[model samples]
Target: MGLFVHGDVGTAASYEPPYTLSSGESVRGGERRLWDNGAACGRRYRLRCLSGSNRPCKDGTVDVTVVDYCRKSPCPSTILLSTSAFSAISKSPSAKINAEYIQ
Candidate 1:
């Protein structure tokens, strides 16, 4: 999974439909696969960090709502977890870590 600061336009989930995140709730942006052509918007997912080299993984899951679409020419990851969400599952928020996510 990848990580992005909430509202950071560069890698933000800026897709349409006007979404807002609940207080204290984790959120993410998904690529085409998870986006499902916008159907994945508002979907919920539970993500667990599997492994990474930079002391990345933590033990437990982070539940996240899909708030936006992640569109990049060469997608970096399936999902881009908000910084807070990434921190919940990994120690290194900037490092890309393998994650197991489910609906």
Candidate 2:
């Protein structure tokens, strides 16, 4: 349900989180990040990742700040996240997860 945002893999030396969402809202470093099905940006939501049958989940719940949109064209995926944000809540970045969202 979540994937790391492009150019945000691992930790960077500069380590600058996106300051402005595509929808024109301010964001900060180290804040939780998420993307949604509607490709909506600049929205905030509470996300809960359920533990899988095969793999255990980490940090099952998180408050996410939406700073970008996930597009279906070109590269298809949903819920792009910053590396740090994904790491905090999920055990592996590549895991397929069942998640709940609350605004």
Candidate 3:
């Protein structure tokens, strides 16, 4: 929910190539993907999109790895999702919908 893509960032700098997720799973640009919270790198979380005006995600939930910091002065939201992760869980990559998270 409230999803946005970070393809502009390219890849995460905290880890090496072949970025493996906390689930021990890998996807294209997995090493480069992440949830941009103020949390430390490699933190993991379970995210669920709550239905609302905009249908955020096709799937109810997904697990995400935090690989970078979202330090925008006027931040859009608390969580910033990678393009791949956002697409996996969201129906539309640009919609902002309600979301819940557990770490």
Candidate 4:
């Protein structure tokens, strides 16, 4: 599905994840489908960029924790990856790209 890359910080975690996140570990915010009524908090996923017209796919995947829920109007994408997570799997930083992910 389409991906949204967050800036320096992630969106608010509705449930307030219980565990401590490792320093430098990437995180993400999810749309409702992934939110699962806040149960998604602290869930981790492995994401890889899908090849697109602009060749936006990178060579590897990024593993990230679900730190929050995406609160954007219309909920722009399936998940919001942190900037570091996005850069690890995508060649184009600002372009919307499809992705393959496993939880």
Best by lDDT: 1
Q: Regarding lDDT, does 2 or 3 come out ahead?
A: 3
Residues 6-87, candidate 1, lDDT per residue (tens digit)? 3211122212223367644445455576678778877787777777776677888777888766656666677777777778
Model 1 ranges with Cα > 4 A deviation: 1-26
lDDT of 4 by residue, 1-103 (tens): 3353542222211122343466544454556877788888877777776655578777876778876666676665676766666778776666566766677
TM-score order, best first, reads 1, 4, 3, 2
User: Which stretch of 10 consecutive residues in model 1 shows the poorest summed lDDT?
Assistant: 7-16
RMSD in order of candidates: 8.5, 10.4, 9.8, 8.6
Q: After superposition, how far is residue 77 of candidate 2 from its true place, in Å?
A: 4.0
Per-candidate Cα lDDT values, in order, are 0.64, 0.44, 0.48, 0.61
What does candidate 3 score on TM?
A: 0.56
Per-model TM against the reference = 0.73, 0.51, 0.56, 0.72
Error of 4 at 99 (Å): 0.7
**How do the residues 3-100 of candidate 2 rate in per-residue lDDT, one tens digit apiece?**
32332222111112543444322222222233334354556655555554456467555555665443324222234445455555667766545555
RMSD of 3: 9.8
Off by over 4 Å in 3: 1-39
- After TM-score superposition, what is the CA distance of residue 75 in candidate 2 from its true location, in Å? 5.8
Clash totals for all candidate models: 0, 0, 2, 0
Write the candidate numbers in order of decreasing lDDT: 1, 4, 3, 2
